[model samples]
Target: MNTRNEYIYEFGDFCVDAVNHLLLRRGRPVPLKPKAFDTLLILVKNRGRVIEKDELMELLWADTFVEEANLSQNIYELRKALGESAREPYYIENVPKRGYRFVGEVKESVVAKHADKVEEDSDKTIKSLAVLPFKPLITEERDEFLEIGIADTLITGLSGIGQIIVRPISAIRKYADSSQDPLAAGREMKVDAVLEGSIQKSGDRLRVNVRLLSVRDESTIWADKFDENFTDIFTLQDSISEKVAAALSLKLTSEGRLRLTKRHTENAEVHQLFLKCRYYWHKWTPESWQKSIEYGSQAVSLDPTHAPSYSWMGASYCTLGIFGIVSPKKAFTKAKELVEKALSLDPTLSEAHEVLGAIKLFYEWDLASVADSLKRAIELNPSNATARDLYALYLTAIGQTDAAVSEVKQALEVDPLSLIINTDVGYILYFARRYRQAAEQLQKTLELDPYFAHARYALSFVYLQEELFDEAIEEINKAVTFSGRDAASSAELGYAYAVAGRSSEARKVLSELEKQSKHGYVDPYHIALVYIGLDDKNHAFKWLDKAYSERSREVIYLKANPVCDPLRSDPRYADLLRRVGLP
Candidate 1:
């Protein structure tokens, strides 16, 4: 087939220049996968007409056998690139059982005069790259979660090199189950190259077979096999990242170089325990949190000087506070002690610094200390998304809503698909009293992960603030079902019931909660939320005071919680806020 003259299609600020193979927004190139680009080309070529999804997929895949899911992913990327909506179509319209259609107008410009020059310029080499989550080598009897953790750590380490646009772990996790071609995964993720690997563990040793592939041609750039004891897992992770960075011709900073050589533990058993702890931590559920703590404790017992294990142990305790499963006083104390021990073992541990900051801000109510710790943590590892997200929370607590939002934006840049970070952004918006915006963000998060408990809970809270009692009840019910007797979820469910005039059920639930609290203190802040839902300000304030006295971490949110807005008008509310150091 003869090559036709290339052209540029312009609509609004978006320009798709076929000659250069680039999509530009306001004259600057926007990063997009080649498949996505091809999809866009097809759409623009048939602008104003609906293109069947299968037809488009056939054009994109050509001779390959690809699933419908691949087409859906392409559509998602296309929409994201256009900043368009799936529900309210602006550029592409979903034809339901049919397919998709481009609805936007296009004006094409002849590019035959500059086609060769544009093509030459398009070949500029990428100075830095990231190898996303590689598909597991095999599907049977695989430890998928552990593989993901290893990939995430490697990406994080490589990102610390400062010159690479390392794809976030959350984005890469989407391809964890991929059985397709490695080149296809790389194209989907819009990366220049990909590191594909398979891990096999036998006794205390690990065998990792890895290959670096150039996405453009599916050509192997480098390949290696690493055989190492489990005790050297961290070192192995560092080696992989460092080798990739070197292959890409990127300069590693002194700190990055140090990290590439650092060893957190040399005990194989302890390392295994730490990996198991990470496996559970990634689960992000109440049950998994407990399991993580158990595994972390085992790691500590086996290697008392292991800083990463202690840091993760502290993080597990922090999760307990968030779930209202344990009193903040107890949880934070343990977190503080573990983090301190971690820092004592290795003051440079970024995770320990981050968790310590959270402990200080939410439990101790020490804003200055939180700032210091979070800053140090970020200084140590800028690629730590958890640290950035927690720092954003601290910013929100201190009435720096705009700054907090900016911090979360940076975090999203690193962890684009992180459910927790997305939920955090919604929570920050909620605290900023932007109920509708919060609802929209949380709804987007739910769309991404329908069963995400925290996002559902936050959506319920946003609905309540918007006076959408019925919607709030529905979401709260979902949260309760997903969380299953989680104290925080149950407390919120009780509140939703009370607000919706299900007084009998609310009272019954509250009674059961109180009875359960006879052995352990029920979170006073949660009780206060339920009372506020009942419009019993007096009881709400009473519980709020108790929560303050108990140093409840939930109380840290009093200053910004919309449910507490009614209480905020009362003098006692100010007193409680001040007492919690939140004023």
Candidate 2:
């Protein structure tokens, strides 16, 4: 049997996940004899150097006397498993009278787990906890995102334990200052426990110290320190979550322990790259989203089975499509492929399901599939704020306004200060046609961050729906300015201008959009919106049809958009709604 300390090594299209004793080629598992597999692992671990003939025998068979021919047969069988030979090795290179070496470039990956404790529990005592960001002290790398990501990763692991409600990253984003008291911070977040930690480096060694504080008493319930080499950094992160379970005196099941300890990739650099890129990705700005894709794609290339990295890549593509940064059909197709691959590698990945659901809802026009993926995502990770936020949007689009409101409310609770999430709440209320309440909610959201472009953009839609033309124009102008006059916001500005009866200004902006479309992407839905404001029914229909064919994102809003009421009477509009798979 393989030991728990083993890892998966990938070269070319093949992967060997030693912990699971899995050998996969292009994502499909390959079967191998136990002895043959062990031989492959020893060769893989010492890939650069050729093992001596006698040394290989002793390593494989500790005390037993293995015949020379038995070792030779195992090598032949292992080579067959890899579809290689001693003559021309694509993976293993065999030297005459000497042993073997792995020839191909290898990426080693391992999932860390908790094994020291196996006690069982029937019930959980602690309900909630917030894992605050870890401080990086005496650091050489000087990367803030990497420092914070250690705690964030632990939060994800702890959240996987069914009995606990671990606060999402957004909840602690504002409390990342090293000076903040953990007990006070936990109380502010309304959690029962606070997990605080710091990472300190001494040469190639790392010393991590963690304390779990009870918010109820402002007392440390548990504290521990871990000292290990830098390469074991992921193990330290996993152990923190395990210790949390241990501290609670609640035993974890095998599945729960696995979830708490699993690291997506064994490459520490790739892990850091993923965290830094994800930090920028969550910013939700056009420039930051593009930057995330560049870095996220790099991590995926290094470890194709890295599910979380694939999830990020898919989400970036999906967001770009929605924001008109890329062609929706092209972006959605790529997004679907990536998310599907991510799920294939790890079906429990909640973020990947959310991306897939978004694609189905916005582009594929498959509402049934969309519902399944989104619901499954939430079921797997209830603390996933983005999944809840997205499901809220889907519910709103389909006219389940009350359900939409409830979902967003839950999301907002987890991410109370998130500008985008707060903006979404106002948008959901607006979809329910509670215009006065929607306006107030949006105003509050804007008050939190006056320059939050999405909140301003959402406010414009509410204003236009309420027929407050001047307010619509003002809010859209703010959005346009804040977004650096991006095509989507500029197009909305043109639409609002047309609705306000400023024909000259509206036409000038229309001309700008027309000119820009020649050089960059301009969603057909935006052009349709401008036509709607112009009361150009035929032109509006024309662009809506184009948007539907291109799977334009805003097309999903056809049923909920109050400004499109004029077009709702038309047969083409109903057909467009039908094509979007909305009730």
Candidate 3:
């Protein structure tokens, strides 16, 4: 028997048995997605040596055409499993425009416990799985979010089971539009099994059609159709999860099984509104956020006891604050109130905890409480990318730049296509003084989503830092073109022009901003940023003082804002920082 085939790598209170495909922390099994486990194996194999991004991608998808973003996502999950941070660098070092290097020291050990037999038996066991977004039986009535939601819910539910590793939703979302072979989708997601389904909605009735297949030979493992009224949607979701778990031969604790059976709301109207809110939530625009709030409110109105609706409502308010669509005080106050209501209804609601954490960090500036809240939220729902992303932001705010980077990386792991998370990572790199890396990240984001105005804005800022004034103006102009009369975009364009000695152009843009401000006051902090870009310290200080008086949301950027550097020597800057509860 080939007992020597069992290869194990040990590092820092953790061990990875490559032969058995097991990860252990403190000698106990640790749950991880299949791609993440593969990533770990690759990193540990090349420990202390930089692994180029292209090489890593090829190794992970030896026979697949997976997107580069998928590789990024896997690395994120691998870091989380190792309890490592991207910014802190205890385990992995990002080579900045190159690749990644595993910095953690490793010791190899050979375990001899029936290694040959275990290896043989593992061939028959399913090691990896992918849950493709369900198709809509009625094409015109396709509810993509609902279909994606079901797949996501199943992936998350199966992830908790220790038998097999499930691919993260981000890794599987690419297959949602895949009209190719199921085996192809499996390969893309790096999974051995593929779960695909279809949904049909007709007035008050619903039907869910599902199929599970083995990618190795393209064999069907399970197939079924769930027919029920709208009132049974939650039950339908649970039944699907249970069937998948059972098919996978995973044992579910009684409590865990019961949790899968519970329903949050019985009202059909509430459920419909919840679905609509989710649809708009993912759109992630100011207009969509407002619509989400309306839909979430309607959901709560239908059933006041629905905790998720309140949580979504709170999230909408947070979005408003994040996008600078409303006064921070108003947005934060509303978010806090709605989150508290959700908590009062169901303290275990993970979304509410996350929103509360964000409010604490961005509004109250309570670092300790913010950390605690995000930690609890992550514990409650490990699959939630938003929770992890916000936690990363909290880390950045508290000077834990490396950890923040890791958190955002993890977020990208769960939500690979998330424009917001990608932009945020660029912002973090910018703050860390990695201007070139920041530009690369932001540029990648722009490539993925050219309509992403904030990413273009970040790119312009990075170009400015690099002293590429023409390139900065070019990027800022693109931002203005896409943003369409956004005050911030206009201000940024004006700043770029002013910094490049195009004073006439700068004033022209500023005059447009002044005109817009006549209808609704533009953020004085934004004005200050532009003036600072123009090297007009007097004008910048004047606007900054106004921002202080108005309590602008951009005040949160004071700590790391390079545009505010000119103001740092002034005593008023210190006073402003103190007023904002920032050091």
Candidate 4:
């Protein structure tokens, strides 16, 4: 029998990580008994070669007086866990009168790693940090996302490292276009250090200057300047991450060390395309997500091995479903496949895990076991606002309103200016039935960007709950104007008109939705909202059943959504809630 080493083995759709002692199929854990797991591990080590039954039994039960039945049971359990039939095995094959052989193709997954990881003792060690945008030094038409995009990338790399809290881009993006000192900004964020840099692009040649500054005394602990072509961006990121880790006195496991240095794609152009997709992706708009899918597909086609691109692709589809841009059935199924592929490739990707969490909550609605993904994502990256927000939503769906609000508040502190995060605070408050607080929170978001449709639309919902028809109309109009008469916003206006006793105006809005459905995807959930407002329970239930068939994302909100107040007393309401698995 051969000895098993420290590496992950990938075969078919499953990954067995020897370092972490985990067996995951598409990022989800599959339980196995200790001996059963060890048995499978040994089989994978010697694939394509059959071991004698006596040697297999001796290796497995060297000390114990285990019978043949026990060995057979272990193999049976392993085959059942892997969904392999004994007769026509996908993984293990029985050689007649001999031991089982692993028939699946196996490859050891290698992540990037560095040889330099040292320890130090210092009072002002970086316990927390914020990676501010890399300033563009030479270009006049600097892409706004490019500035923050560099920071976001660094945040992803540094998140998996132990003992240092890295603030996400959402928390510090307000300073991206400003000229604030790194230490001062870090002081405001209450972090121990700040990483700031500048990028100068001259045709294909690129110059990057970066510094890690201690917030305590405003002194530079590490600083460097790199001159290379655009294609070497991955190497530059690796160097910066290593320097930051070394200066902070952080200890990284072999696997964690590999995470910071993994390359997404070798083609520089495809890498840049991925950055562009992420930039538009954070916008959280229907049109922007479509653009993300476009560029992300290009990147995937160019380099199929790029896990980051697949992670972002999953996120785009997840966002589209969550925001009601498309049907959750189609969108989330695609998202699930992409995210599972990403996790199967790189198990430590916090971003991919976060997308998986979203898919579980908003699409699967499988709340009982959904906490694992959300918690793991946040545990991997505490500064990740998106993961935190999704967890908050999950808590709310299960009637943990206070915990949900607390979680969102923490996320908001890390990303005060993010329109989506800010808007979500109001939405969460609304779910808690704190109408006044919800209104106040949403109003603040509108102050940051009145044109942001998400905030405007959420404010309208708050007004509707409070029965402020005039205010609701005003905010809904702003949303329609900003979103180009979007289906959700229009349907919301119809609800306002119906509840206000303006039947003609309500019918006019419904007519528009019907016409728009001919050209684009209109959520049946939106139509059901209008029927609910019209006080037509039969029609509302009809459309709602249609929504359930479509797996509409809005169905998750039925537990807390105030617009469904009229239907709350009906028997079907409880059954609907039950079917959605709400608390």
lDDT tens per residue, model 4, 51-123: 8878898998787554565577578868878998788699999988888899999988754322221122235
The TM-score, computed over Cα atoms with residue i paired to residue i, of candidate 2 is 0.75
The residue pairs found clashing in candidate 1 are: 50-101
TM accuracy, model 4 = 0.74
How do the residues 65-89 of candidate 3 rate in per-residue lDDT, one tens digit apiece?
A: 5456566756776777777778876
Candidate 2 lDDT over 1-583, as tens digits, reads: 2223446799888888776566778875554545677888888888888998799889887886545755775787677667888786888887887877777899987775433321111122456788888877654544478667887798788776545667887677777677788888887677778888887777778888888888876778899999988888888777777887899765566667887898889998788778866877777777888888788888888877788888888888899888888898778888888888989999999788888888888888788767678767765676777887988898888877776786688788766767888999998888888888998998998887899888888888888877788888888778878878764437788788888888677777777777777887788887888888899999889988988888888888889878788898889888877767789
Worst 10 residues of 3 by lDDT: 254-263
Reference-based TM-score of each model: 0.72, 0.75, 0.75, 0.74
Q: Which candidate gets the maximum lDDT versus the true structure?
A: 4
lDDT of 2 at 374: 78
lDDT of 4: 0.80
For 434-487, candidate 1 gives per-residue lDDT tens digits of 888988899898887898888998988888777788998888778777766554
Off by over 4 Å in 2: 1-125, 139-141, 181-184, 249-251, 486-489
Clashes of 2: 0
